[model samples]
Target: MSSRAPWIVFGSALAGYLAVGITLSLRFGFILGDALSRTAAAQAVLLSRDPHVSAIGFIFTPLTGLAQLPMVAFASWWPAITRWNISGITVSAAFMAGAVVMVHGICRDRGLPGRYRILITVVFAINPMIVFYGANGMSEAGFLFLLCWAVRRLIRWVGTDDVHDLLLAGIALGLAFLARYEGVVPIALAAVLVAVVTACRRGREHWKDMRRRAVLDAVLISGPGTAMFLVWITTSWLITGEALAQLSSSYGNTAILTQSGGASGDLVQTTAFSLGAFIALGPTLLVTFPLAVVLATRRRDLEFVVAPLLFGGVLAFQAGSYITGSTFGFLRFFICAIPLAAVVVVQLFPAAGDLPTRRAGAYRRHRPSCPPMRTAAAVAAAVLCVSALPVTAWAMLQPSLSSQQYALGYLLAGDPSAADSEATTARRVIDSFATERELAAYLDGQALPDGSILVDSVYGFAVLAASEYPRRFVIPSDLDFTQILNDPAAAGVRYLLTVPNEGRGVSDAINRRYPTIYDNGAQLYPLELEVPNTGADQPDWRLYRVPS
Candidate 1:
């Protein structure tokens, strides 16, 4: 295949992804799921009195929102851009497109045949999770792109022993850390691997020199990335008046773990479950991934081992999150490994007969042509790639459902609407509450004096997006629904909007704590306020007057 062929393929795939993303944004008015919160966060940052002290601090990382700032600013200047989620979707789609290109580059670096590289790149580019997240306004696509680029650079450094490559890898990893907190896993792993390799070289005559170099390498690789994280944390502290404010907040990972009662069992089980979830994302991977690993080990292939090790590091992070009960079941967390695993599976196969031959001794050694094992590997990989198609199609069609649903929804039914009816029902409730214009007008009309509203993070986004006075609202991360209700006036809250059908435990708690406020089941009546019932399956947004 020609050198230009992969670029052409990448371009085509990227165009396709962009088209899908644009279409979804046009149809839905926003990218679904967390994209809503992310968009709102970006808007909040742009509109906040002090961007540092805004609700953006309550979220995971500010990089995604900050990244959207330019586009958000552009949208403010150009009304046409606001019709769809052009900024967020474009950013995400661009990252995903870059990832596809990186996959091709990784394949090319590994000396895989052009056909195999193209095939692997296409498969990864169109994988359900990749397609869905790529087009949405989320951080996963950007994080995945940086991760693939960093891993590729790291592998190149390992092969060529070039310090420049190592530095580049560190830089990429550092940028990735800024993209998402999970990016630290690779940085930590790379540092530890450098130290381990240096220690294992102790028998050499230049052992002391190697040790010194290794220490420097480890520091160089981890230092910048660590610094980026520290700067963010320190800035957050200065802004929020709490060190580690991101993690200590109610929405923080540590708080979530504590709320979940911590990990229930051994770390091994958590790891296994996490790995299982990753495999379940691409079911055929269950067969092909292990076979590829075994074959790669038998062949003593560094590329294969390194790829899986990097992917394993990512899974280990997820497993840690699971074990600590910081997060339970979000498969997009594992999507970064999918492309890497696909590359490994494709590389496991023997190159096609037409491929150009490299110099005999230059690590392009061919196997002894074992038909049985080769055929088995090829068949397993084919099965895995083919198996992903159904889910990929479903996800492309229904990008609104969560990644877990994408992985398992098909088993419930073939038709997406039937398979994920629960999501549809929930969405109906959400749409009813998405009464941005109506709610904003009503709140403005009320003209309550010295009044502010308190809402959960989810509804906080809704309120912020719908209101002109977003700064007046408080989304207290430290308080629960009951706590907030106990002294709403003290918290400067004059009204509370509750969506009972959403099934948030806090919503249920609020209902139980103040049954009189919710006498009409899903409706609340206080200060003679009545929540309009939009329709059946719609969330009953019960607005209540907070007691002074």
Candidate 2:
């Protein structure tokens, strides 16, 4: 248990986690999900108006909008996932740095040997989801860091029965929840454990004293967390018109949740995959399960204290989710429990006593030497770290890695090569419509400048057109919607932008009534001709010029 061993293990673990993060980011970089998330962040940045302002208006902006401020500031900074992806990296790194400190704090407090401490650090660094999800720009990494830090604080508080400690725990949990909704699980669990511990004190005087302190701790901890929560809700309402709009508009929508009706399968598969990752990581459930088994017979009291916290966190997370795919792909959601599992594994093996100390205390204070086990464990840990390389490499080549296969693999992987490939393919596919660009150029060159132009393409057409002529263009948010029927553009638009992505319903509604003013693979039609009314699918697109 050399003192320097922890540092060695820390460096090795960090290197491995970063290797996986970089690989996934480059591979999945071009995915639409990454792009959309980047766009959302970019839009947030654009809306910031002033990055240095720090006004309530800055805070009032939606999170998505604020995340994009960096992107909006520098157009050349365009990356598929927004320039703020760097912020995501910062957030993840902050949490991880905190965890490393927390691990050292816990090891010192417990007076564990260097080998045991190194093993615990190894457990944390190699946790699979931690490596994969923490590397992305999402809140999962920060949230996990807070959750782990809070648990460490809770452990210390329990030992000292300190109100300040409890308050710190509360603040961490509150901030974790602010980062992501799923953070409430660990927060609630910690509160419950504190309450139970207070209630279990033996003497009447001790019980009363502990109870009073417990209540005070609860108040101090819960107060700031509650206030922050309310602030989050208020901020959401100011931006989106509702307090829970982000969750309600997307995750809670039943249409998306039960898209195929057999959502049970999705849930089952996700649960299985999550469980599998936990085992594969070798530091989490793999360590905890063995600890639980060994402790049940050898140290039942410690098992009672640890098992419930471990199991409860997992159960609470599972119970809270409403949708199937919500937990399916991203392992980051499960990283919250990794620290607990690592603690359990560390606690499972009794430390080997110093030879002189053992001789001094003899039977009165003897502990097993853990140094021998450290060498074997280090070897095993090295093998596990090496095993991840092939899995990561294989992940890079899969179609899911190259595409936004959110249903199957890590969401934050952000494969840059894959993203670049997709971007190229999207451009090529869009370029096939030579006429769309021609009409767009012609429209840009036109005299009319104050009205909207209708269009049907999803990404390239709408993005390019809108980017080129912001005021005169209007795009459908719905990817599958047909043309503007009653001609909303008729009232104001001087011209139309059409693309092949539009199906029959659009052409049937407007093509017969509008004469072809310009025809190409991308067609431009004048609203001067007459046509019948029928709700049917039609050809790609024809731009029409409405007479003023």
Candidate with best TM-score? 1
Score candidate 2 by lDDT.
0.46
- Residue-wise C-alpha lDDT for candidate 1, range 363-390, written one tens digit per residue: 2334332223354555556566767767
User: For model 2, how does the per-residue alpha-carbon lDDT over 374-491 read when each residue is reduced to its tens digit?
Assistant: 5565455435444544443344334432222222233333333655754444333222323333444556566555445554323223233213343355433322123443455455
Model 1: number of backbone collisions: 0
* Model 1 ranges with Cα > 4 A deviation: 1-10, 28-31, 49-55, 77-84, 198-208, 254-276, 290-300, 349-384, 391-433, 436-458, 466-548
Model 2 residue runs over 4 Å out of place are 1-39, 46-87, 202-209, 238-241, 250-255, 258-262, 265-287, 290-315, 319-332, 350-548
